[model samples]
Target: MDMLFSLMSPQVFLLSCMVALLAGVIKGMVGFAMPMILISGLSSLISPELALAGLILPTVLTNGWQALRQGHAAAWGSVKRFRVFLLVGLVALLISAQLVRVIPHWVMLLLIGGPVSVFSIIQLLGWQFRLPERGHGWVEAGIGGFAGFLGGMSGVWGPPTVLYLTALDTAKTEQMRIQGVIYGLGAVALFGAHIGSGVVRAETLPFSVALLVPALAGTWLGFQIQDRIDQVAFKKATLLILLIAALNLVRRALIG
Candidate 1:
């Protein structure tokens, strides 16, 4: 209450909660984009640093639920299957996170947003791509590195990860679980990295904690919707959302 108000006014707080709920719902349905939505929406109402801090806990917790929804065993399987990606991404994320204050925001946004938007548009136009049947390790490492680099700077890594998964033609349930595993681990690293970067401190901690209620509630609702959708519908929904998210990133870069 007092702590949350300290971060933003009551009206802003209300709007921020609404954004969190929306972000959570989308995350639940498609298994990504919470950070992009949170940073974009909350940054409009609050400082970017505070917005980054505010998203930390909710992203962490929601991703935890997403990762475990299928069971621990399945989540572990995803971890093992994508160990190279996870290792490279986490390492890159930790290293790039330290550069957050050094890099220009627009540069990072444009670099990630443009390619992702193009990729999504191509996919939506019925042009599909798949990873090579042999020797994909290098490809996974490259995409993971790119995702981690963007994630460390902006807290938005879903686009590239989603791109990689889509290229693999991953099944819906598996894709959801894999995203949770990837993002959940990455979120933990982000929490740690930002704490060291002084983005998440005592002052911003409460604001992050306060959003958990609405975020969780929205994710539960999204899960209900997700359960009702078939694989084709899920893929379409994911791509559409990805396209919108990518375009929003581009818009922010251009507008800012």
Candidate 2:
């Protein structure tokens, strides 16, 4: 207990717990957004690399649960279809992790936030856009590369994966499942990468473990609330959160 107390500052610990609570709730309701919520909130207190490392285990565990429970057979199909892209993306992430000490977080924020904002706006506006079928291999590779690179840097892998899944016109259940599986896989990759790169260290373990309690409690509460909310309303709330997250990234890039 004394050791754990020493690992985290009072304010930082409190804030981390609160963010974990909120992120857990959001993930419970929407089946995604853990990284976005946690990273955004934690950035105020911790370095971006530390924040990214902090999320690795919990996000993986949570999403692994969701993927197996909800995705089941459908998730396998997604894995099979996108295996090449996924592998390539993981490779990119591994390579980028080596550069954590050298690369600036602001560059990653701009890369991830800029595209996410533009894509989200276009999607929200209901624009009809389609990737060409003939060049899908190249497209997949490009997105996978970018996703891996940025994911390693900023812990924001959702936008590229989300965009790809959206373009595929995946059903709602499949969408959630695919996200869960991808996130779980990414978490595993990130764990290895970060550990090797020394981004996740013994000093951070206590804080990570402490934050999990609030995360679990919040997720349970969110699950209860999910049944009471309409789908449209839930979607709207998710969009709002996404907007806020994007704006926060931009602010961090430009001002911080």
Candidate 3:
């Protein structure tokens, strides 16, 4: 508590609480929006690196629970299907951790946001797209590399992963479960990578814990509202949010 207070101003604390709450709700509902929401909201007040650090543990905990919630059968299935991708991505994330300080934040934002935005727009328009048939290993590896690097730098990996999953036409329940698993794996990898690289220091722990309460609260609220929303409306809302987040990333990159 004292450490949390020391690291954040009253206003920043309050704002972080609100953002966490909202992020939690989104996560509970969508199983994937928390990082995007939190990073997008917190980046204005905190350095991007700190914001990324603060989310590391909480995201790991939440997503680990989410991934395994559906029982071992489903979880294992997802793991088998995406194991190679996951392994490659995790390794890439570990490598990216080393470069966190060397790489400019804007460069990461541009790398992640530009392709993500373009892909999201293409997806929203109902275009039929597919990954290349040849060099499947290389293609998956490349996506994983980019996702892991950006995830380490910006704490946002969902765009690439989500796009791939969506393209696979995964069922809603399966999609959620897969997302949970991917996030869990990514979070665990991030914890090790960041800690090894000195990004997850003692000072960041208190703030991460402080943010958890609001995140849980928001998640509960989002669950309550999720069932009330229709599918079309949900997709539209999600797309809008993605576009806004992408724009925000682009703006941040350009300005900073």
Candidate 4:
């Protein structure tokens, strides 16, 4: 708590809690967008470095929980199914993550915001892309690589991953489980990559740890809401909200 208090003022702490809570609920209901929400929301209130650091623990926690929601056997099944995508994404994420320390902040924001906006809009427009079965291998690799680069730079890989899955026309149940697996594994890679890159340092660790409570609580509450809502409507609304967040990120980068 002392470490948390030292890293930012009380106002910022409250902001972080709210951001984490919102991100968590979306993630639990939708199985994506948590990191995007966290990064997009937090960057406006704090430095990108601190924002990334502060999200590490929360991301790891939420993903792990989401991934295991269907039980360990199902999670492991997803891991096996998407093994190549996971490995390539993890490797790319680890390598590109170090760039965070070098790349300009505006560029990072665009990296997070641009793809998110474009991809979400594409989905909203009812576009369903299809890859030939023969091309699935390279396509998966490509998507994973792009997602890894985005994740490394801004701690967000959900948009591209979601688009890829939807393009495959994966069933809703499996899509949710797969998303959990990919996100959980990505979160693990995020924790490790940032720790090595020095984004998740001693001074920043406390902030991340403190966010775990709100993150889990919000996710649990979101699951309750998910059961009663019209999923199609909720999804459309979520995409609209994400679009706004993405535009906000772009605006911040441009104005700054």
Model 3 segments beyond 4 Å from truth?
Answer: 131-137, 227-237
Rank order by lDDT, top first? 1, 4, 3, 2
TM-scores, all models, native as reference = 0.98, 0.89, 0.90, 0.92
Query: Sorted on TM-score, highest at the top, how do the candidates line up?
Result: 1, 4, 3, 2
Q: What is the alpha-carbon lDDT for the whole of candidate 3?
A: 0.77
Which window of ten consecutive residues has the lowest lDDT sum in model 4? 127-136
Candidate lDDT values, in order: 0.91, 0.76, 0.77, 0.82
Highest TM-score model number: 1
Model 1 TM-score is 0.98
What 10-residue stretch in candidate 2 is worst by lDDT? 231-240
lDDT of 1 by residue, 179-248 (tens): 9999999999999999999998988999999899999999999999999999889988998998887888
Instruction: Report the C-alpha displacement of residue 8, candidate 1, in angstroms.
Output: 1.2
Per-residue alpha-carbon lDDT of candidate 4 for residues 1-256, written as tens digits (9 for 90 to 100): 7877877889989988999999888877777777777887788798878988888888887888877878999999989888878999999999889998898888877776787788778878987567664458888999899998888988888877877776676655677789888988898888998889999888998888888998899998877776566657656755776687687777767886
Identify the superior model by TM-score, candidate 1 or candidate 4: 1
Which portions of model 1 miss their true places by more than 4 Å?
A: none
